[model samples]
Target: MVSVHVTTEVFPFDQSVDLCPDNDALNFTTIFLITFGSGPTLFSNKTPADFNFTTSHSQSFTFDVNDGMFAFVNEVPDLNNGWHGNASDYTTNDTDGYMFLVNMQGIDPQIFNYKIDDLHIGRLYEFSAYVANVVRKEKCLNKPNIRFEVRAINESGNVIAKKGTGDVPACYNMSWSKYDISFETTHSSVVLLMLSNVAEGSGNDLAIDDIELRVYSTNDLDDTSTTASSIFDCKNNDEDYCECSNDFIGLSCKIQSDDVCSKHDNNTYESLFFITFGSGSDRFYSKTASDFNFKTDLKKESWSNFKPGAYAFVNSVPSSLTVLWHDAAKDHTTNDTDGYMYLAGVGNVNDMIFNYNITNLCVGVDYEYSAYLTNVMRDIRWVSVTEPNIRFEVRAVHKKGDLIAQKSTGDIPVYQHMTWSKHGLSFVATSSSVVLLMISNVGGHPGNDLAIDDIQLRVSSANQTGFCYPG
Candidate 1:
């Protein structure tokens, strides 16, 4: 077993076998899980998509003309002499197994990387993998050293945690050695897991298999400052099935916390106005509301000013201005189909980008107007003109009638990457009807390019009733 020194309390799993090649080494390398801290259904048996190595997305050693990086074999293959030929996989028992015949050569040290999403905040996770140093002890040039790094994907690649497998000694009769590490997650929901070969020179080759990662039990979370056992309140101390605390409502108390995860709860709110548009269609926006923009795309119109509803679904944005512009990132929706975003270059007037009128709302009830916007342009200097300024507004009757409530996203500064920010406002429905509008706060300038998405007007879940549109 690899001894890991993390901040959290980690109980060690002993592998008492000596590093020297010996008989009965097969059993020492293959215990997949100890099943200790977590319940019976502790680890997720299947491989996570983020960390998995597949044929199409091969993330491994540099492709050698002789050995060609890696291959799927039952055991260590014979390259030259039979030093590593004795290594056999003990985890997968089948004709086609999990063992990887890896060859590390050339300059690139990175083995592979994976993406993780929707991790529970402050929850403990155990990551483990099996590997066998392929080099013979006497002829070992460089002992295989592996490094694991976790970086937040959305936070402009900020590192959260890291660990290293100390120089793996040569051979368990050329058998496998297990490596494990435990980490607690922070607020970052999306992360990248990268495995890199720390050692340079030859004899750094290894056979790796049975890579696994899953959530395990923790006495407490960093954020909540309370034990998961107490928050879950499992019946009869059954941790698997339990009752959630406060606003948490999910199986095993593993849903998103922070009270507002259920803001769009299917039973709580009815989508009164879901902002959607057509393929540069001028008829659609004006058809819904006469006061909306007469046109969608502004490429044909003047840059001095823009009309209300003069918005277009600007889903695609070139990552760089040079050769890779064709491979721009699509809209923010995570579906199999292509989704579009409201892309706009706000002109001098800080134009009224959108307007929608809905009728017969339940008076005295609550409603929320929300939209996500991101600045598509960047600036080397901190010029405020390059940033995007968006406003979400709610009003009674017509577009310019009595204002109900409003909120403006001051100046959305340029981030290292395209990071979307959500802006919203809540109001009590004084009248039976209201108009929702999206206005630009910044006039035409150097950097007012914006991408907007997921615009919605929803009634409070608790106040949502069928009578909201009752005849």
Candidate 2:
């Protein structure tokens, strides 16, 4: 007989076990109950202690007899001896000073059913246990292969959710490892935690301990603060809060921000406009309202000739330029479908420059300007520029020609293949009216011809605290 101790008022037990002369030396060969703060609790002191395990509770088991299939004991088998593999072969911390051992030949799969009640509807719960194969030898033919499963059952005995550990071999030399199974309950009902053997021979055996079931609320698993807003709110510091969108980081959402410009083109902002050869035809933008277009022309004459005030020129030299539109037969990549701006510079004359007069920008707000650039390749007859390096620059200027912010893609290799690359920079706007966006090829090399597309300028809304860059 085993003696039981009741310590907490919350847990009450009615059954009693006769005390053994030496409680520590008592080795029971049948299922029994041992009392402790954290170890497995008893369903009842009766013959079969199954079907009473509940949430947030644990139960411990041990082998009943040496040759018997299932048994419960207070200690692990001795080290490296027939039943015991090594001195250290045991459960984790041996909290209850007990463990359940399963003999492979007799009871290949030992099932334990738990009755769960008072569970909240639509709640998630985690069931886990520490399991290990008691075998220590690497080449031992009877290595214990075990698995743990958790299944939820409704009042009608219908299974709602089931999860399991397929196969966990005792390859860790008797060391204990945890197995976890989680399920979201649809209806308040019972849950079953089962442990079974995958190996069938006699030498295959396993030990299990520290079984636990825990319930968690949805709010506990959500990382985002409910008090924060989805979009960044830079103004109301007291009442306004922010939970930066994915890819955006920083406090106040003032740092690394989302790409305002994707692979698309649009006049979403009234101040936004594109520089093209004609009023509307051959626009240096995509034909698709929100898609990028990367089309080129053999000669600048194919479109309207460059006119002063319509386009920005760097060297004051007239050169042929065109907007490339998407043509399935010509474009190498489908990434830029609408079209892109192209410059066919004359040798020794660097004259490509783009200027836009933007209005109504928020003063003192940080903004990011970005665009995609690549070397255009049309046909074998088209001359390929092998400058090896190309430089692109962007600057924000006032109507008075005062430079507000300036950034550049220092130097990029002009590969022979057609591959578009993104370049961008962040800046703080100083004024709202007449903000000028200057896109230029600062390289002095005349043949620095390239294609530019998907230009965008938007306010940066990523958190900008302590060394964090704008997203």
Candidate 3:
């Protein structure tokens, strides 16, 4: 048995080395060099073949080429302006004679396997190879794509570290290129290197040559002090303690910055008028009256209503026969917290209308008005008689009743029962003073009933630009 000391060295096999006994035996573990090509003494073998060798460390390495999948060619085939025509295409020494030409797809695909012993744990190793795509002028069908993978496995057969050049696409009429991949090993025992053609069946063809691997120690890495200084370096104009780049915010530069709405935050928004219709004075529904007459005065519980300067109305009346306003926990589930109640009614001859007037809004500024709605099947028998469609519309009007903008939640098929859905319209205020938000049911069917809650009108920021009347 021969003992070989494996040290960090570069290997370029320019001299004669072969697996055959007639030629000099390649003691890979000792010589640290190997090449796949014929010398002046041997005739070039064009057929696909396998070269197998054993390392001094007793690890087996096999370079297998499938029958019709690959060939040892001396020059790139004349096509596509001779993409890889240069003799020194992908070789470092520039004295290239033979290279592995792979036809990405065939009855059997091209593959190579090599086992390495005693890799340093936690150390980073870089594997690189020169490769070129053989371009064909005819149709240019299936182009070649290749991958070089390295896996560090333990005795238990579990992969501890894995890395690869995922896929390299064919470079048409381009020079041979070098690709490198780096990985840190978790296990120290062995490393398996595999080179494979990953392109799909047929046309994709490429050539590969001069594969190399190098190990890097931790001390060889970039200076850590430079990285630390850049992270903590504060700029004079920045409000945060650390001047973080790449959209990183916060004192420690830990938070990723997001698109901020000028007039609104994640939890709250700038609202001219808002109502949740929850408990207490905020409740917008009444049991005694058939409709809310905001023309007289503002109701104690209502936020916006019909008045001398502004007007609002709702054709809603409490009924004992149907399920109306109740805590979300009582019979329905709402998006809001406890005590969130809702108002509901069915479409009839006089459509169920909910309208309010908002005043003192900023002109030319966009605002979003939204409300939650849920299908309520108070009477299941009505569902069979009426059309299965429900439509709702919301419009923004000026104080003098001129239309600003209008949007509709188009015919939504009744599927989810009692599930709260949100419908909203964004509009820009044409007048700075008063705006009327009117929500009404346009689908006038007997059973088209829906619950409405959490009406809100807020200033729109960010990409919340409202849509205007399309000409």
Best by lDDT: 1
Give the TM-score of each candidate: 0.38, 0.33, 0.35
Name the runs in model 2 displaced over 4 angstroms: 1-68, 79-96, 105-108, 142-147, 152-156, 171-173, 197-199, 219-471
**Order of quality (TM-score):** 1, 3, 2
**Pairs of colliding residues, candidate 3:** 142-204, 143-204, 144-204, 294-306, 306-311, 306-312, 307-310
Tens-digit lDDT string for candidate 3 (1-471): 111133223455434322112223232223222234543311236332233322111111122323235555556645335344443334444244556565555311324444566667666555445566565322323334333345444444543322222223333243355554444555554443433323235455566665544554442333111110111122234343221222111121222122111212233446545555444332333432223221211122342322112121123322333342222322133444333444334333223345565555656665656655554443231122121122222234533454454333322223323455555545456665444433332223343444455566665554332333334
RMSD of 3: 23.9
What is the C-alpha lDDT profile of model 1 across 281-336, one tens digit per residue?
23112232232332332332222333322344444664433221223555555452
Error of 2 at 281 (Å): 45
Candidate 1 regions off by >4 Å? Answer: 1-268, 276-311, 318-327, 382-384, 398-400, 466-471
Error of 3 at 313 (Å): 39
What's each prediction's clash count?
5, 41, 7
Residue 35 Cα positional deviation in candidate 1, in Å, after optimal superposition: 63
lDDT over C-alpha atoms for residue 117 of model 2? 60
